[model samples]
Target: MSAQLIYDLVPLGSTLVYTDGSPRPPERHRKKLAVWETRNSGGRLIRKQAEARVGNTVLPASITLHKGDYGNQGTIVLRVHQTFSVNSDLKFAVKERPAIGSVLVLARPGDDAELVHLAANRADAEEWLTRHGYPRAVFREITADTVAADAVEGRAAA
Candidate 1:
């Protein structure tokens, strides 16, 4: 499924909200200004600057409120500053969903057992495991309905 990627250029003094419904106070280090420049093949140059917030925990500028996985729980909240639209194709690529007939593998450290990487196939996973010096890796086959079931379970848990 595709979704409309709508957002506003967060203003200088606006505060953002966290996913847990808490407000994040603006701070000096949390604010950042970035400048991007690009040159096209036709010799046209373009420059743009954008402001963003950075910290341990940062809130989203906009959100789709009250839309439950099972059904609609309440009315959607469309704030004035958040009301904007962009026409684009959005694909939600979940990591657990590998290509059909491929294998999903998790590379973990030998000493710490921490997940280092998730590879789509056994060959790539083995390569990563060897490169990272991981002792072992876990592999699972991707069936037709495996990804769909996992997605549904994830939504329900959330």
Candidate 2:
């Protein structure tokens, strides 16, 4: 029941240049570049870091975007890395049958349900549901066959 980690890359700004010796577009100067990380709890994602990166060349602590301004065009790419952890253990009673290699989701009463764990076997799934206080009726299981079919579909779509 550990949390999941998510990574995202964002674009902050770009280095600009002027053509025909014109400064019509005011130059926007920035000191340092940064990235932030957040956690998702109860369907709410919160920002946990204010300044994740700064300009650093030797220590390799910050990230820099380098792009050339050609024809009054400038482009820069910023990479943002994030990690999140969620506790997925709950205690409840089991009322449904379990299957191997099935994905299980725990549904809470007024809150969004979350993926708690993957079941290796019927016993394991049943035990997890019973211990996590999740009723079998509130739990949804995606069987291994279905997962394989979904993977095939995903590959085709891609």
Candidate 3:
């Protein structure tokens, strides 16, 4: 699917995998394998930015994925995020979506809000919010109706 489809249909916090449609290189070709790895990997959808204009320049809409986190003993040291424009050449697929009854912890309330976390329930979401400080964060619960609509519309990973 195109990145635009992902931005439009796939819900935030869903697991996504993007590929350049190339076969994996043999391990012996370390350099080639390393390059291939960059073009093929999975991550959690986190943020989406709409098209914006800065002076005379126009920036295309984009989506950000949380690729990985590096840490030790509960301390996060590094976070890797990959942002892809709507016109990205790579193909993308939704690997998983937040299940019904799960709660989405969004950083803010709007189309551009980022998914900060996904909690099991309202109580869990409240507990998590107490621990993390996102003053303007909004919580959205996935409902059965939402799942039904997506399933009927063929929003599942393709």
RMSD of each candidate relative to the true structure: 19.6, 21.2, 2.0
Candidate 2 structure quality by residue, lDDT tens digits, 13-128: 11111112222332342221111101111221212122233566232122221222233343324423322322222111111223434534444432333334445655676777
Q: Give the higher-TM-score candidate: 1 or 2.
A: 1
Off by over 4 Å in 1: 1-18, 29-103, 107-114, 151-158
How many Å off is the CA of 86 in candidate 1?
A: 36
lDDT of 1 at 16: 23
lDDT tens digits, residue span 1-158, model 3: 88988877777878999999999999899999999988899899999899999999999999999999899999889999999999999999988888999999999999889988899998999999999999999998988775555543555435
- Model 1, 1-158: lDDT tens digits are 21122122111111222122234444443432111111000110011122235786543332221111232465434422221112223221111223555554434323222223445667877776676554566555556665345334224211
lDDT at position 61, candidate 1? 32
Residue pairs in collision within model 3: none
Lowest summed lDDT across 10 adjacent residues in model 2 is found at: 5-14
lDDT of 1: 0.31
Q: 124, model 1: CA deviation in Å?
A: 1.4
Pairs of colliding residues, candidate 1: none
Write down the TM-score for model 3. Answer: 0.91
